[model samples]
Target: MRVLVVSAPLVGHAFPLVPLAVALRDAGDDVLLATGGGALAAADAGLPVHDVAPGFDFGRIALRVLPRHPLVARAELAGTAGTRGAGLLFGALNDQLTDPVVALADRWRPDLVLHEPFAVAGAVAAARLDVPAVRQENSLFDGRELVRATGARLGATLRRHGLTELPPPAAAIAVAPPSVAVQDGWPMRYASYVGGGELPSWLREPGERPRVLVTRSTLTGPGDRGPMPAVVAAAAQVDAEFVLVRPDGRSARSLPGNVRVVDWIPLGEALPASAALVHHGGAGSALGALAAGLPQLATVGPGDRRHNAELVARRGAGLALRPRDVTAEALTRLLTDDGLRAAAGQVSREIAAMPAPADLVPRLAALV
Candidate 1:
């Protein structure tokens, strides 16, 4: 089977699809990834990739589209309204990529077009070719709702592609743990892939203190550090050793003797030895922590960060606090709370019990 996979041009957006894509490839199917920008780095995983949207800057697109939609603009990427705004912005982005993606699909003629929820261009291409479009859920939010919300905004693109409406996905590949999010479709165990890197000696060995992993989202826009500054300020008050991933040197100026800043390390590799996590509520970070059975303290803010953070808290696996609410007390609780630890372990086992990506290969191939 020839499967064409589509994703938005961001690491957080693209990385989630890697496991299933690799599964399909190992099963001997022809797989090609269609994305651009930072997501193009997915090529390092050994899959053939095509840049469907060259020179695409999501921050630029967000700036242009957000102002026109005040509800989304003012929401600071929080709440249902903010998510709706994201749907519209993604719709606008799909408008730019539809023709190219459709053209690529025309040439590639994939039997199945599998894509993350935001890449509606994949849906358009599938409609244009009369093939199956499979929705791959990479986050806690439902793809169908997002696509439905985006419907009106997609009028022009649908018309251009000779489609009256977007087709429902023939099937779905859901990765979110069921307890954390009520995801639909075939349940596949989420295997976290944080890309490759040289591991530091400290990461390979257990730290002397109760180590807390601190990180932020990969897409925090220009000049926006999210909650890192707050985390840094509070780091001094916490007694545990803090390993922060990839903070700018300027942000690292503080002499917090307990804090260690590394340029990069794979979360998948680091989570096993860590006691807890503190991060911006990116889906990747939240899921990775869950997979490792680590309690989390997710700093909620704009976009789907709040959404992701709240779900973890609702399940008792962690705590969700606004950036301003993040403090030393919260960090302390994350490391030492017994209830959070048990809930996190339960969620981890739930995730581990889900079917592996390889188990879904036959089902996906059968769709063709």
Candidate 2:
């Protein structure tokens, strides 16, 4: 079977879908991954790929789109930006990518289309081709909310392509542990895939002290320096060694003695030695920490970060702090708290019990 996997121009969107694509490839299906920013990461993972949004960067799109759309601009986690506003914002994004994706799908003639939720282009293309489209869902964020919020915008776009409506997803490959996703989806174990990077030699070797992993979002805007100062303060308060995973073109402005920086590495690779994690609440980071059995402190940012932070906290595995409140005190609590670690371990066990992507491959044969 030929599979076309579509994703938005962001790694945060694409990374969650790669595992399933890889699994399908290994099962003798031809898999083609489509995206803009995440195309490199997918290629690095050995999947064949097509560019749907050439020359368009996720950062640039965020800057351009957010300013024009006030309902979504600086919208807090699910803030007053109702579904309609989110839907319109999502509609425009999907609309921008739809033509290219549809063009690709028309040529490829894929038997199945797999997509990260935000890439509604995949669903549209699948509908055009009369093929099944599946959602590889993981994040607490739901693209459906944004799509549903779109009202006539989405349908109108569909009508332009000779399509009157979008069909329901053939399946949802759920990866989030309970309490995170709004509804339970068909279970597919998350197959972890962080972008291409080598694990540092020092990180590989055993260490004397309990280590803590720290990271910031890679999708930062020009003015966004992120919470580096808070991380520095937290490092100073903790006795543990801090390994900061540096995002591209970003270096620590100031580093505490306990904090050391390394180039991009998979958070999964960093998890075993990590006693705890402190990070901006991107979906991948939050879910990765839980999968690894590490306690976390999610510094809430705009978008789904708050949803991720709140979900983990509700499950007793982590703490959520607003950006202003992320401090040494919070770091100290995350490191010292025994209950958090225990809860984290418990959730880790639950995640481990789910069916891996490879395991789910046979089930998808029917869909194809």
**Model 2 vs. true fold: TM:** 0.92
lDDT of 2: 0.76
By TM-score, the best candidate is 1
Kindly report which residue pairs in candidate 1 clash with one another: 77-303
Worst 10 residues of 1 by lDDT: 220-229
TM values, all candidates: 0.96, 0.92
Candidates in order have lDDT scores of 0.85, 0.76
Tell me the tens digit of each residue's lDDT in model 1 across 254-366. Answer: 74888888876777888888899888888888999999899998877777888888999999999998778878998889888999999999999999999998999999888
Tens digit of per-residue lDDT, candidate 2, span 1-368: 99999988777778778888888899899999888864456788898878888786655555566677665674633433435444655567787889999999999999999887778889899999999988778576565554455424677678878877777888877787764555345786665678878898778654777788878886765323345557776677777888878843434756778888888787788688778888888788888999888999887666666667888998889998876687777777888899999999998988899888888887777886
Best by lDDT: 1
Candidate 1: residue 287 lDDT (0-100): 93
